[model samples]
Target: MTAHQLLGSDRHRDLRVRAERGAALGDAVMTSLVVPAEFRRVQDEYPILFRMNQERTDFVALALFGFENGENLFLKGDRWDARYRPLALAIQPFLIGHAAPDSDVRQVHVDTASPRISGDGEGIRVFDGDGRPTPYLEEVAELLGELDAGYRESAAFFAALRQHNLLEPFTLEIELDDGSINRLVGYHAIDEQKLAALGPDALGALHGEGHLMPIFMAVASLGRIAELVARKNQRNADG
Candidate 1:
């Protein structure tokens, strides 16, 4: 059974994390979160696209890893081959949760089923013998703080995208080396035409809100698709 409990020095003091990377640790995915705060870092390593939520009320930026489902081409021998790891994938089994059902107080929780976590003393200790958090735990706290802030920033960033009509549904046509053509649908990206048509006042509003740079960054990120295609071809050839 999967359970998430509040971290405590007494209860989780002996816990350790093996810290594996890639699919073995559940990193296999076609897309994951891309925070506006990390847009510059993500654009160089992966293709950035936007996808509508299931409710269709909003969109979320995604860092595309592969052309197909369950295909993270960035994974190589259980190691991620990227300089900057997306915050959504960098931290696993750890999240900030409320202390109570209606409480506003945030606390850290972990997924007990995660393979990265252990009680066999094989990974970084959760706490020191004096019942204080270890450096690993401290780092986890910092990561959670950053991830939380990034997502909050995204809420406003995506809202701005929607308000400006800057997003459009997109489809990707992929032709693999093995003589198969595939199409990816149901995602969105910046509509350059609409963006260009915006009046100066509107553009100034976006710029003042700190959305201009990330917008151009996301647009420029389309170039990374060539790199992804090349990697896919290499993987196919190696098989």
Candidate 2:
């Protein structure tokens, strides 16, 4: 159902993408993959959590949006009720692709099946009449570049966390105002006790590796969990 194509000016000269926020545009998600580079902004709005991939080979960070699947409490009509959206979510319909598995070259790929792909000249144009990329396309390209670099940085960060044994399994339990219980499992969080127990050598190693700030940011992000619950309660009340 995904029709990905290498974005080219000549082939997609008239291509337009709707830059709107809504479930119809694939914005209704409970979590978005985040990287350490965006942790400062993400922690301010969303709780940063960690989860292992389906293969259980690597750990990926996530910005939590809701407690349930496909439930984005931040969705208020067509607007996302947050100042910062995780890059993984913000870079919709566009993804970084490689020329080959062994190639370092990156290319922009567009999902042609996305609802954001406009056919009636109802959205932002990718290329102008001169075949040059529009401002929006340029911005998207920059975002993709950042995302690509962030992914590489994230792999190193996760490896460091594993090396230090700083991640621990976590389960979140939420009780709504209406007395309904919700549980979030299969996730991990920074082990504060273990972090505090680290000696000067380990601390220095983490700081030297440029991961200390983001680790603290991820820890600080847990405070946003309460805010997330409040949003869910408000959503229920509205309904």
Candidate 3:
């Protein structure tokens, strides 16, 4: 259902991408993949949690937006309520592509099938009349690069958490004003007790590896869980 092609000025000169937020453009979601690099900004708006991938071998960080599938509480009308969006979500419809399997070089690839692909002249242009990347494309490139680096750095970060037993299972129960209960399960969060009980040597090791700040940031982000509940309550009350 996706047609990923290497983005080229010659091939996609007139191609435009919609930058607005909406469910039709695939913005509807309960959680978004997040990287530690953006944890500071994400923590300020959304709770950061960890979930096992399909293979259940490694953990991936997520920025929680709602409690149910296809429900994004931060989505207010056509605009995202948060000031900062996770790079993973911001780099939608575009991804880093390699020229070859073994090649270190990266190229930008676009999903031609994405609803964000504009048919009319109603969105941001990828290339200018001079057949060069527009400022929007330039920004997309930067976001892609940062997301790529963050994904790579996350391997070591997750390994450190596993080695130190800093991740633990988490379950959340939310009660809306209408007294309906929502239970969220099958997620893991930073184990504050384990983190605090670590010996100085272990703590120093984590700090030296540059994994300490993000760990705390993930913990701090739990406060936003209450925010999500409030948003959910407001949505229900409005209805």
Candidate 4:
């Protein structure tokens, strides 16, 4: 089934709720702890920051270090790689926290009943409902790993919000490379007046202090921030 079909009925309901509430949690943490840390580090390392794009799923912050090739890097939320599974799983609880308890939400379970290497002898494969080899098994494994690692942290944060009854309404959309999108999860409406009172600068400072290192490290591993920007600009111009 396609990703949308795979979402099933319950998943769709969860998506709707997340689209309305997830952003408050994401925005609060990111603006307060993630962005400022990144800004400080980038500023110290590079002479200038050319463009910084922060959306719910698409987060691209870049800096320009005037080396021979110039240096650039970006952090992204969506990836097909297995390495990100832990992160995805970590975020799942928060996504589902606002889900209706009686919703037909079912955990995905893989049957490792029989595993075999592919015909190409290059990788292992597993059979699904029909006896066909599921593609991207390796990628799935990596995602699982990321999910395992990330779940606890996400749960803790989500729990705190629930305890304080501060769960805010927000939305989250995952834009894939195939031009299709998925609404992952959400929460309740937040106190806008209080959030607004924090102001942008204060929020920025918080992000810089708390989340900069992890975000910076993730992007740097993906690509050179400077190069990515240059390539993006080139693509826009050509288009």
Each candidate's number of clashing pairs is 0, 0, 0, 36
Question: Which candidate has the highest lDDT of all?
Answer: 3
lDDT tens digits, residue span 63-84, model 1 = 9999889998888877888898
Q: CA shift at 80, candidate 2, in angstroms? A: 0.8
Q: How do the residues 33-135 of candidate 2 rate in per-residue lDDT, one tens digit apiece? A: 9999999999999999999988989999999999999999999989999999888877788999889989999999999999999988899999999999999
Model 4: per-residue lDDT, tens digit, 1-239?
Answer: 11212323233222211111222213111111122223434343332221222444322222332122211122122221112112232232222221345755433333212122122333332333444334433345444444444443333433332343433443435333445443423322333455445657745753554442333343343243344345434434554
Order of candidates by lDDT, top first? 3, 2, 1, 4
The candidate 1 region of ten consecutive residues with least summed lDDT is 18-27
| Local distance difference test values of all predictions, in order | 0.85, 0.93, 0.94, 0.32
Off by over 4 Å in 1: none
TM-score of 1: 0.94
Which sequence of candidate numbers ranks them by TM-score, best first?
2, 3, 1, 4
Count of clashing pairs, candidate 4? 36
Candidate 4's TM-score: 0.26
Candidate 1 vs candidate 2: which has greater lDDT?
2
TM-score for each candidate, following the candidate numbering: 0.94, 0.98, 0.98, 0.26
User: 221, model 1: CA deviation in Å?
Assistant: 1.4
lDDT of 3 at 137: 96
